[model samples]
Target: MIDLITAGLDWPVVVALLLTSCAASFITAAFGIGGGGVMLAVLASLLPPLAIIPVHGVVQLGSNAGRSVLFLRYMRWELFWPFAIGSVIGVAVGGMTVVQLDPGWLQIAVGAFILWTVFGKTPGIFKRSGPVAGAFSSFLTMFIGGTGPFVAAYVKAQDLERHSHVATQAVLMTLQHGLKSLMFGFLGFAFSEWAGFIAALIVAGFVGTWLGKHMLARINEKRFKLALNAILTVLSLRLIWSGVRLVFGI
Candidate 1:
């Protein structure tokens, strides 16, 4: 069973991926953001180049979907339809181009995006138009694997309290990743071969999310906001450093 679960990799790597899933879910659940970036960085080393994004998409879709369901009562349903429509449009448009970017450039872009999410205000359009925000962010998520910070920034701008913020944002990501994974499958990413591993990871993420939600209930708004910014800053800086090193051939 242990050997089977390892998927031909070392035991440690498999264990790390599981643990990363848990930790990532916890981070995202507690603060309503940051987990996807951590898991994406970790998964890049564990999986082959091609499977990385699609598998990440599946795992994230499950994780976010679970969070959305867990807090479904608080979901602002009015927000869903516009975001969903925009995500579909964005994915269709992005799927047409289908160009692979150099890793360093992508990393730099993601790093810059994270920094913007960390320090930036939600644009006026994002504040006003859910569909526009959805379209743009979903398109961006394709190029850069983690758009949690960006989505969180937009949701925060809606001035939702913590529970609604988390619930609404989870649903938003669930839609984005669902659109993304289907697009990847259409492009022949081979989700089936990795199904078992993906399921295990998603289950782990779900547990972490459950635990994190409990913590979330205890956190006050001010502390939660402070922690969210702090985590985003650290994660963004890490991405920037990684991009710089790769670009410099270090």
Candidate 2:
């Protein structure tokens, strides 16, 4: 039973992963962004190199799916369809032409994109950024893993209410992570090796999302928005630094 739960990992890593999953879930549920990238960074440092992105995809799928289910009432289905359609097309292409890219270059591109999205002041862009953002994110995510910040940046530009923001973003991430997980499975990534750990993470994430809802109610809109932007900025900077180190082989 202990072997099953650890899935070849040490007990300490399993505990750390579970705790991070719960905390990351709370961040996403309460702030509607940042958690996925932060979780990916954490997992990257812990998991086997080849397994990082695919496993992260599955874990995030469960995490975001739980959040979406909890906030189902506020989901914006009308906007979701167009974005999902674009995502399907993008993912299809990604699935066909898949190759392991230079992780450094991928991080560089993602960081630059996130900074641009956060600091850019183009009102007209948000009006139609959904499909474009969806397509871009879905394709990139196939190669580099967590591009949730890109999608979140676009969603932030949409000016959604707090609850709607969390629900809608959760749904969108669910679609992306679901597609990525399917792609990984189809490509012969052995998810069974980590089944016990992933299941535990999902259960923890659900509880975290539930707890986060209570805190979400107390956070005012202004502070919530500020936190979202701040998280994006910090994550963007981290990505850039990681990219630079990898590119320089430092």
Candidate 3:
């Protein structure tokens, strides 16, 4: 069994993983969510349970780094500092504690949280923002690989234009994922073993981001946001279902 599993982790599998990363990155670049969560789901199914979080974190680091570079000019510096600081602290705690907890519950909680954020009716949900909100949301993101919806809500509350919204998210995600990768490394996740795979995914992510940028320019922002909401909704359901199955063994 062990040999079969290890053998399955060959070059062809690596290529498939990279392609998956590329597809996820493209969706994220275009719609601002789904990528990390989707990648996490796929990786969780393929890898040893122990390897899932760190491996997913590393790939996300590459993807978000590419995005941050592509959208560097639109980053809102004021919004960056608080979120970055909180994210660093939160990710450290999360990385240390995650393996000890019931991940199924965590997934359910995160999925429920996303659903609430997307469907809830609360005044000033997107109208109020500052260091406090940024820090809070960034802290939440540490437990979940992708917090694009939360970031988007905050940006929309601030009424940033399309470019600023996407760019700010790209920068924040870059910081979060970078710190996550570092934490995973500290935990002894072997990046060397997966270097080639990571490199391929990074290249694919760059290409996807480039393509997405063009698509972003041509689409109507409202329509894009609507589509994003739908994608997130479906992802949330999948997460919830996966968590339930894990907990129930059904």
Candidate 4:
């Protein structure tokens, strides 16, 4: 079983990643966001640099796909269609121009932007700018591996109900990560070697989502917003710290 699940990685590391996948999915499913960023950080720490983004994208694609399917009824199609269109364009451009530019500064900027958006009033342009948000976030995801906070901030600005917020964000992430995985495949990442490991993560994430769904049903809108903001704040701080570490070798 261990050999089937991993290639060169230690068994302990594989176990850790499986657990992280489950916990991260629970966080996102219950709160509407935060899991992808958390999972990305964990992957970056544990996985090879070349494997991190691609593997994270595949795991997230499965996690988000499950949530989107479970809450399909609440998705905001108007936002989805535009975001989908822009995502295709963004992924295309990103794949063509994908470079190993330092993501440290970008991470810092994204973290700061997320903090401001969560605490202050969002700009009028972002209130209904699905295509713009989708394009920009998708482009970044190709480099960063987790643009969920940015996309979640966009969805949050719409002032959706709890269910709608979670539902819409799930579908948006599903699309974004799906495109990213395909891009990585085209660029020649050997996903087949990681298939068993990835499948284990997806199954763990699904269990987490199922548990989170039950918890989400019991939370009220006001409390959900409070929790969501808190989670975003912590994630933003983590991003900033990670970026700083990368930039200065701290």
The candidate maximizing TM-score is 4
lDDT of 1 by residue, 1-250 (tens): 6544665667788889999999999988989888998899899887988778888999999999999988999999898898899889988877776576565766677667657755786567767788887887787777667777767777877888889989999999999999999888888887877887888899999999999999999999999888877877787677678778888998
Show pairs that collide, candidate 4: none
What TM-score does each of the candidates earn?
A: 0.90, 0.95, 0.84, 0.96
Candidate 2, 1-250: lDDT as tens digits: 7776788998889989889988999888888787788789889899999899888999899999989888999998887988898798778878888465787988888888778877887456655767877887898898878788888887887788999999999999999999988988998999998888889988888888898888899999999999888998898888888888999988
Superposed by TM-score, candidate 4 places the C-alpha of residue 106 at a distance from the truth, in angstroms, of 0.6
Which lDDT tens digits does candidate 4 get at residues 1-250?
6766875789899889889999999999999998888788889899989999999999999999999988899988888988998899889888889366688988999899999999888988888788898898998898877889989999999999999999999999999999999989998999998998899999999998988888899999999999999988988888788889899999
Between the candidate structures 1 and 2, which one is better when assessed by lDDT? 2
Candidate 4's TM-score reads 0.96
For every candidate in turn, the CA RMSD to the true structure comes to 2.2, 1.5, 4.0, 1.3
Give candidate 2's whole-model lDDT.
0.86
Model number with the top lDDT: 4
Winner on TM-score (3 vs 4) = 4
Number of colliding residue pairs in each model: 0, 0, 1, 0
Q: What is the lDDT of candidate 3?
A: 0.70
Residue 141 of model 2: what lDDT?
90
Shift of residue 172 alpha carbon in model 4, Å: 0.4
Comparing 1 and 3 on TM-score, the stronger one: 1
